[model samples]
Target: MSRRLTLLVSAAALALIGTPAIAATPGAVSADFAQTSVWGGGYQGQYTVTNQSNHAISSWKVEFDLPAGTTVSSSWDATETVSGNHYTFTNKSYNGAVAAGATAAFGFVAGGSALPANCLLNGATCAGVVDTTPPSAPSNLKAGTVTTTGVALSWTGSTDNIGVTGYDVYRGTTKALTITGTSATVTGLAPSTPYTFTVKAHDLAGNQSAASNAITVTTAAGSGSGSTWPLKVAPYVDMGSWPTPVLTDTANASGLQNFTLAFVTGNGCKASWFNAYDPTTGWDRTDIDALRAQGGDVTISFGGEAGTELSGSCTDQTQIQQQYQAIITAYATSRLDFDIEGAAVVDHTSVDRRNAVLAKLQAANPGLQISYTLPVMPDGLTSDGTYIVQSAASHGVNVSLVNVMAMDYGQHDGIDMGVKAQQAAQATHDQLKVIYPSKTDAQLWGMVGVTPMLGVNDDSSTFSLANASSLATYANGKHLGELAFWEVTRDRNACNGSLTNCTNVTQQPYDFSKRFEAFTG
Candidate 1:
């Protein structure tokens, strides 16, 4: 429940190269630039030069453009070369030759203004005049022939008065390749990982064109997301509920590898676990650590039936967003469930605020997944529930999963609970058809999920062991997005009375959990 500050980078201002100072024959000696910044009395800089022969190059004016909050960083010894109006940069042979042509290193150490992050210069060639006009941007950059380890890329060529001589291909920020043709393949990438690429053309006069439109492409099969659950079946566990269940013990007992820890509420615009523990201050982390140690992961779910969800309690949207971000970062979780049931569903203002935060988070984090857990009827999502999805879509928040609370649907006579749950899912899918008419049926199925109450539900209908097994089968057959139950603690017990702690009518200790855990997709 606090504010955190992050510094981005001290980046590129200018790259002014000078002639090599030698008596006989002048050649390229050293192309070094000094970039300085002060962050908590610390300094760091990144340097990339084509070649340096240790010549005392003079008259090179090093400039600084410290753009705040730009990205990718840390604090190191400012490498303090000198102080005052001038700077002398001493180089460190940190990394070997980057790619085939560039020598990359870091320099800078002086007391100066604090700067934000990630600045990069394309490249330059020493020219007599340094021509002003660069070529037009490359057109229609596209990816083709993707493999497990590489992807082939091609783009339409650019033209200018001086004429285009070469093309520069970029993988993210780093220049990956330079070619005469418009097509090349970037290799040595990890499988199943997403990569961003762009293309820019340059003239013989050393003027680079603006980069073309970017494309994000993925390599085939396998995962790079370490220590997180890579599957689709993660059940909910009430962290603030009775019995205060141990996660590691639960995993060992039920053979479940993934769990969704629930209910990070708010206390005066600060995130709290039911107003009891501050999530950022290492609260209830021992179990989480132990669970991760065993190759299992937990999704940190915010906003439950608990009264003050962060958005509802806090009018300041930024404050609420920061708390949500902090919790996600603290857990290193890819999955986040917003349980927008119980009053919060109808709280449209809060819903919009939450959606805005989610949209930003998704855009900033490429791999982070977001889902909405809403109350559902056998017929489908209520009007309020549909509005939540509609608003999220309108705000540019891609809904990863729409999980339905398939429990407590009043009284039903003689109908199988599993069939009722399926009905709710089908109805919801049909509703999604109206909302996202462009999406295929299979695509809609992938967005649907159902979570039912185990053992005896609050209403007259009881979700029996048969119901759990049958529901899992249906979810697998449809290739659904996810399958979760209410709370693990309730399923762990089989006692009478005490609705919150135990499932009133059931057979084995964790029959329902085992059934749902069997879901692999």
Candidate 2:
């Protein structure tokens, strides 16, 4: 027989195979049902029917006798028929005939004053249903007594029907953490701040039940250590991409524990040049304020070469200076990052000019931070013969750190270019330290773009989650300041290299549209 015909015959034979069956009353079908109470609202029910007859069943009908105080709401796959408070779901027709040894399924939804008890499926009566309910009431949900800059929250495990898949943690109204198989630890909470926490259980079907009891805990005071910086893992929320505030906030809700940093467009001048900020319609001060109130920080980044307007008459120094002041004063931000690329023709004058601009800004705001980004150059040479590292330092301008665009550099060349790029960055850092003896390795920040599509012809150059993790480990081992990516939207999360992987340690997503409220410990 043909290959396709042989496969069909095998499937038919397998379908007909069965074990010995017990005798049952004629015209009667044995039905079993599963019911689960969902957390937000509503309940889910699953049903299985055994065809005890010697013949095949073409169709089936399942009638659920809901107890007092419940009513049928809606259902899927089957048509729900209601009479008073009871619900009956009729299977239109089985896609394939169910053999005597096989089983089928049908279910419906019911709404009522309270959860029903002693629900019956088909003609069979069951007791209070199966207690497939997951563990409940996450007790002792408080921060550890020995408070520190971080908050330690613990809770009891939840029960499940077959088994509990995991626990999702929420800080106040925002989901802060997702822990598989129960326990999870939430770090990077601000010192001396109070936070509310709640936990929920997830089942194999991805069904999450009601939240456990709520508890509040305050973080300990800060020790003025650099490690104390709130290190959280949050999702990326982009206002420019999401013109609507509601959509932006919803996107943020997916990964609440992560920091939210906005992507603002600046012409290498002031911070708010082509401001996407909308007070009444989209992300505005209110959004930022709300984020801040929730123990999150909002940072605005400038100079994205992708589509930002960086070339124009605004390149003039007077306009640049005015725009800079406007951005800093209006936004009240302590730090600003300059994405220096493409515009090298206009901005690359001398380290003296760069330092003068930066110093003037710093003098105006004593607490301001200035960071410069450089294209990943394997040779670490500017077109003007200026050493990027030596020039910045000699001009009395604290470069903060360099964000080497490694992906771009490698794509232009190959994977071998990455190693060369890393070597160049290390060499520059070493040279800087030799000149500035007090400077530590913590001042260097490595930039890597996490994308699935390999830029260079070499497949090994593709940035995967594993690649990010390995790179992060390397940076940390070298005492590098931190790892930053080109854009969070380009991250691959689905393992297929299309979605952003928020869980990746090397490059966590940061949403910049939200507010920076103080942590309430």
Global lDDT of each model?
0.68, 0.46
TM-scores, all candidates, are 0.58, 0.43
Candidate 1 lDDT over 110-195, as tens digits, reads 34334422222222222112345889999888876554455667678898764576788899999976655666656556667899
Clashes of each: 5, 28
Which is the leading candidate under lDDT? 1
Q: Give the worst 10-residue stretch by lDDT in candidate 1.
A: 16-25
The segments of candidate 2 whose C-alpha lies over 4 angstroms from its true place after superposition are 1-239, 243-263, 266-283, 307-319, 350-354, 378-391, 410-425, 434-438, 441-461, 492-521
lDDT of 2 by residue, 414-503 (tens): 345335545655655654555566644453322221111222222234444444444444554554433454334433222224222232
